[model samples]
Target: MGLSSRSAVAIHALTMLARWSDKSLTSAEIADSLASNPVLVRRILGSLRDADLVRSTEGRGGGWLLARAAREITLHDAYTAVEAGPVLSRHPHPPSDACEVGRNMQALLEAEFQDAERAMEERLSQTTIADLVQQVLTIERKIGRSAR
Candidate 1:
């Protein structure tokens, strides 16, 4: 019914990577900033890595790195990487055919859902992770808080 937090988490992790481009970061470190479980962060990171949005290494001095420049990565890319299904998935079971609204609801909403999905993807495509990082820093500066 609503946008999943996966997109938000992916964007946040990407922004953090962009802000700290000089160093690789562990899932635990990124998770701390998100105030989320490291397992969740790692799961997201795994998807990002598979999507070529991030790369990782193991051992001492090992951590995750941006696979490409922040400017080359789009929110749409991140969104697609983590989300497995349509932005608005249909109900688990179709409404009863006995009900007129229930029988036609899916058909009626399909186009609108498609349009919404396209618009969302288009918007996401227009903004890169670098843009997001800049936006965050700008907001912080305006509020007199240092971007960390």
Candidate 2:
């Protein structure tokens, strides 16, 4: 919705690993949960691996595992691990200096965009992968009760 789905994929992969922290998970398994393909999952996971958020093994029984505890990894950690560039976005080309509005817009937009991005980053830092796992289980419990 914001930019590329890299952050989302990375976060999803993280939570899945945390949920099954007792064992490692294959890219195929994580991809299945995402309704995505294994190659894309591996690509995003590779970013996480480079970021030191996850680790993997090779050969038989090889898979992915969290490098750190879920509680120790914030949404911001996952976000920055995979996604790059500014959050809000900027124009590809600079505005014209001759036009009054165009001349003023870029500077104003820059400040606004930076502020928005900082706010988003701060909010993301407040939550962790562990928090999401608990929330998912809590919601599932409630839904199960209602279905009875």
Candidate 3:
């Protein structure tokens, strides 16, 4: 299955919130970082809000923030919030049962695909938004030092 960009956007947004935890961020700012539009950010943020990973404020001087601590939120949290279904997709149509390989392919693919999906989930769960924020900070620090 194709990896959805939604998960990337959600993680990026969450890391932004954590990095700038002192203040709320408007969707437009996040969108600008993404080179995307506010509408897409809002929609993805909506899904994250529904998952309780994020919260939003409205009106003047209002925007979005994390609902929980960044460390409490895992990459799996972001992935699940915005994307659904298996990370590995099966065949578009069931293989013909008449042929030997076709008959066995679906089952074999299902087992292997599920394993891959589980492995990805395991890896994602191992990481948190806080981890990404720190990585970003470290990279920026290195860049600054090099510039100086």
Q: 41, model 3: CA deviation in Å?
A: 0.5
lDDT of 1 by residue, 32-148 (tens): 999999999999999999999999989998898999999999999999999877888776788889999999998888888999989999999999999988998889989999845
Q: How many angstroms is residue 133 displaced in model 1 relative to the true structure, after the best TM-score fit?
A: 0.9
What lDDT does candidate 2 reach at residue 63?
Answer: 99
Could you tell me every candidate's TM-score relative to the true structure?
0.90, 0.94, 0.95
Candidate 3 Cα deviation (angstroms), residue 113:
0.5
Give per-residue lDDT, candidate 2, residue 95: 87
As a TM-score, model 1 comes out at: 0.90
- Candidate 2 lDDT, 8-61, residue by residue in tens: 999899999998999899999999999999999999999999999999998899
Supply every candidate's count of residue pairs whose N, Cα or C atoms clash at under 3 angstroms.
0, 0, 0
Q: Residue 37 in model 3: shift from native, Å?
A: 0.8
What's the true lDDT of residue 5 in model 1? 91
lDDT over C-alpha atoms for residue 36 of model 1: 95
- Tell me the spans in candidate 1 whose CA falls farther than 4 Å from its real position: none
Stretches of candidate 2 exceeding 4 Å from the true structure: 145-148
- Give me the displacement of residue 85 in model 3, in angstroms: 1.1
Q: Candidate 1, clashing residue pairs? A: none
